[model samples]
Target chain A: MNSNITHDLAVPLNQEDKAKRAFVTALRVHVLQHMSGSMKNRYEDYVKPEAQKRGNTCDTPEHIHKALKSDFMFKAYSSARTCAQEMVFDVVSDSVDREFETLRAKAKPVAKKGSLTLDDSVEIPKSVSEIDVHLAPGSYHAEYTEEDFATGAVYDNAIEVFSFGQFGKDSNDIGMTLSNYVRLKFPDFKPAKILDAGCTIGHNTLPWAQTFPEAEVTAIDVAAPVLRYGHARAESMGVPVHFRQMDATAMKFEDNTFDVVFSSMFLHELPLKDIHAYLKEAYRVLKPGGLLWQMELPPMNQMPAYDNFYLNWDTYYNNEPFYGTFRRQDYRKLLTDAGFGAEEFMEATMPRYTFVGEEAYKEALSGENTFDTLTGRMDPKGTRWYGFGAWKK
Target chain B: MRRIPRKRRGERNRFFQAEGVDELLSALLRLSAEVSALKDRVYIAEKVLEQQGLNVSDAIEAYELSAEQEAELAANRQRMIETVLAQFDNSSDVDDMTDENSKIEAAA
Candidate 1:
């Protein structure tokens, strides 16, 4: 990558703000790693044994919560996690707040690009508006004024802080990993039109456009702020991506218009009904034999019961209400229900290059990878990308 | 002394049992930012002094610090990254996760 493109694509912060951002990011990593380990130890050492002795099954999320929520270890873990979540917004928002006028001004010209589109009348469902998704303040869609992109700027910085730099330098790993798998899986397929649903900042959207430069990439989100910011982000990086403010559940695109439909870590944020609607819509938009891939959390049923309980903490305590419900559904069954047959559905844990060695990545691409039951349920700090979807035929 | 923007209006964390932790975290971050600013200023001052062919070590030699002052200076002048990481090094939770002590098998 050109140094200039990489520099321009980064969110700018002065010396002091940069230090604060780095501290907050480090703090988040510490809490998630050390503190999380302590929580698990406490559960195993005390809560589980006590519950089992009391003749209660400690296998389900409800049982675990009942036995552990009041424990001091759980409380500390919850507080630290909540504090880290809130502080991420504080750090990023503080860094960006000083240059709010400048960023808002920068967004205007970017939206004027012929490839960018904004619809003022798009509806933001309550599932998005009623709560801050991922505990982010103001969620993704709120705009303080016309052409405001502050929410997107905050998210772009916060995710980097939250991911601890594991999401690639530009946080484009999810897109890059998924696109690589698509090419390796179907070597002959050439998608001419790709649609990325619920593309917040087009971080993942840019990879598909880069992988298939000849193809036209169109990314849609209901959030105007992110769409505006994503357009500017893509422009700054010199990647041509068409961004639109549109709902994923009911996209305005014509049927059989897209050659590929995809999303990354997007479905679990939505309510169950909306997820089904979105899946049906994704099936409707893709052309016959076009691929529909979703990079998401591992399905709950596929994991050991303890891993399921561990990953479901966010659903209960982090304000991600729909996460548990979404993970519990069989992804293959969901796709088959959405009109694709069982044979058309495929699921795999893609090799995360940042975690896996170069040789392992290449081997996995060649279909030499073995996915055990615990493949996708591992820690985020480690490698492996969980994905599942179906082909429209 | 800069006035950072207040958090966005509406919606608070429903999970937290207490309030002051977020404020404390924010205050610590601001303090870190101020310390970083001072460090940057000191770095530039040192560079400029060096350019003028002056050595900072001469000033330190002229006024030797008491043991207490030396320790305080050492703590204050530690690299920001080292100071941050020292917390992790001191953590009991991290120590207990060693291969010999770990109770559960590592994630597959």
Candidate 2:
């Protein structure tokens, strides 16, 4: 059942970008495997022992960071990772930039049944606008042209390279895995209207539409470029998704709307205050007995202190300012405060659909071969996404 | 004093908040790419010469390869296949699937 639409899932890249993308892909593997291991060994062998000799408990993120920051291996890994992150964008940016005019023209009149509604008045939040999240130049919302979709294209291609093909080739694992989990676990629950908040380029958004064909799926993001690109991408894939540029903090939807309000890899991008606001908005928009699930980085409380520090490296050095703060929050309390009862709240881990095949995924769904306990140790090879939410009753 | 802009403007990572490391990596990458490109060209040239009924060894007139040299090179090739080609070959299968999907999308 191939939906007929425009555009290719594998973006059109010239020879140079192709080579650069390959280089970036190999470099990511090298950095993650070799360089990351060296850095960890340095911490274990030298940094931790030095801290212990100094009579300091090197358990907290601050203590760990203090001990590891000056280490050369740590510096090399950090720098290489940062460069690789930026290179992911740089390699793809050229291809998108080269075809900007033609791509925009082609996208504007895609003529798919799915719609794209952009509200120019929506203010770009400081968390996204102030810092170039993930060191991506021009951030997500910045529009260089009247019909610009380059930022979204940049992100789409960049993420494919960054994940090293772990995000199910097209970077839809988060959405597909979570949606599949919901389907298997709550077999009786059928969402009529599904909403994906902060859906960048709608990579995760399409899975819901495919998973629940009867449901009318809507995905919203503040970035016009991503929204525009997402709409075209969805149309090209023949998935009908209504993509709108709207603030997640204060959505324009009426009360008791969507049956399933979901987000993926989005909450960490917002400040702690905005996270609360977003949760409240999620509560406001969700109908009675509706599900509000968020798939994001595992909270700090779930992991050991060393793992917390290791994960929080992004907060201090990866341009994600609120990552550390958001992870430390008690999510169960946040859900309860947002009008969800304590009994309704649930937190679980699902293996990324990209790494584990359908059989293991089914095993995970049936409460067998679960990876929730291993959430403390973040493993790229054995990838698992952490999710938490509550039913609005 | 500097009038013309340099070809490679060193870009810094905002998060790392440091320099030199990324710059060094980039520098090394350029040399690595050059080496790889040269190797690629030699393979291409070998193929072209083979098709033209002119062997590269015949043209070059280099020292004769000993049986020991041949065995060592074969061993090196085997090791490379196990180490490098094995990982990439697996990834390429997934990549091919993605490409097929993209082709379908394009056709649609």
Candidate 3:
């Protein structure tokens, strides 16, 4: 089933556009499932034995990448995957462009509960400005006109097609799974104020508001267009979430302000230094005894070489330049370096809350992290979401 | 009017070692997508006409375009061809073409 965005700012796509999106989604799934399996079979049948003859075990990600470089199956898989990635944005861009003015007008804030704060002086980091970051054409921060929300609309619409139903109905599975994990895992930790950093369109941010209805939720991104669009989206859904255009590395909020600082699939988009900077900022803004929680792909150390290579495919083929680098870092060291004690650091792999019901999810939390070829993949088998956090002193 | 660029900014990776193989693959995929889109549009048109109590298949087969209609359809076909082939011309900016098309659409 094709999952289309139903928000107020959603672009109206014609039948052909919908078909194109559906085709792209199917193509991506086919590549990820069938082609990936074929590539692995070719590796096991031919590439591995050849490497063994050359005295190379092909144990590292770099080795696996190099070994697969000349393989025809790998080449076909990579090319098709790249084409589908580009087409995801291309198929949705025309509809968004046609309704750009209407979407901009619709994005006007009507929220009675929350507010939008755009900082004109907030510099767009080179990581976002220079690269398209997932081959998404304009990246996250591009502005076509005054108060333009086209980028946000494009992202919100295309993500459903891109994720291929892995991100739940509203593309908020990451937030839903993580927030539920936090709430269930730490039953006594009641947060009154929450902050979501690098919250593009607030897809993941809204779940926090839903999970903890009493918490005053605030979300920040460097892009004004996305913040504006996100504000309108939250308001239309009757979920009050304060949206702000502020860099995560240098947030405008005062120190020790939030009871919970949250992020999901956000850290891999930044450079290693920026990741460190953002974590330190998260540490500073979080109140004492607060939690710094994030949902991300498991670290490289937690997986074997093949799984690492499979997960880091985005680093080589996709536009995520920092993906592999971020994964290679020691998760424990990252939190500890940012002032959280090593003893207070926590990690968990929980089943998707939306997929498996609450009871099944709660039961699955005690399960160990499963590492295989599909650990961080979009396959049905990889239903687990990895999260780690540390409690402030 | 300003148009958003459909083409992403970056160096495109060539997966195949053979010359023109990657380009051929891209063109083939584009063709497949276009074919799929066209099939869907035709299906929707047929269904809508059928729901209106019109015999779409018979009417479509029996109908003949007027001179002006034929000319318009010819121009649309040419535009579609150009749109499909524009990928080969690296100098052609998709945003610019989209802007020009929007101007034409507005004029129409």
DockQ of each: 0.13, 0.07, 0.20
Q: Where does candidate 3 stray beyond 4 Å? A: A1-4, A380-382, B33-108
Evaluate all candidate structures by whole-model CA lDDT and list the values in order: 0.74, 0.75, 0.82
What order do you get sorting by TM-score, best first? 3, 1, 2
- Give the per-residue lDDT of model 3 (tens digit) for A36-95: 777777888898889878877799988988888887877877887888788888888877
Candidate 1 per-residue lDDT, tens place, A79-177, comes to 656766777788778767777776655665533332678898998899888877777766778877666788888888877877777677688888988
Say which prediction, candidate 1 or candidate 3, comes out ahead on lDDT.
3
Q: Is candidate 1 or candidate 2 better by DockQ?
A: 1
Candidate 2 local Cα displacement, residue B15, angstroms: 10
Across residues B7-106, which tens digit of lDDT does each residue of candidate 3 receive? 7786787888889877787777777566768778988999998899876877665565577875675465445534653442222244576789899899
Using TM-score, give the best candidate's number: 3
Question: lDDT tens string, model 2, B18-80?
Answer: 555456655554345554776699779989989999787545444444778656744543333
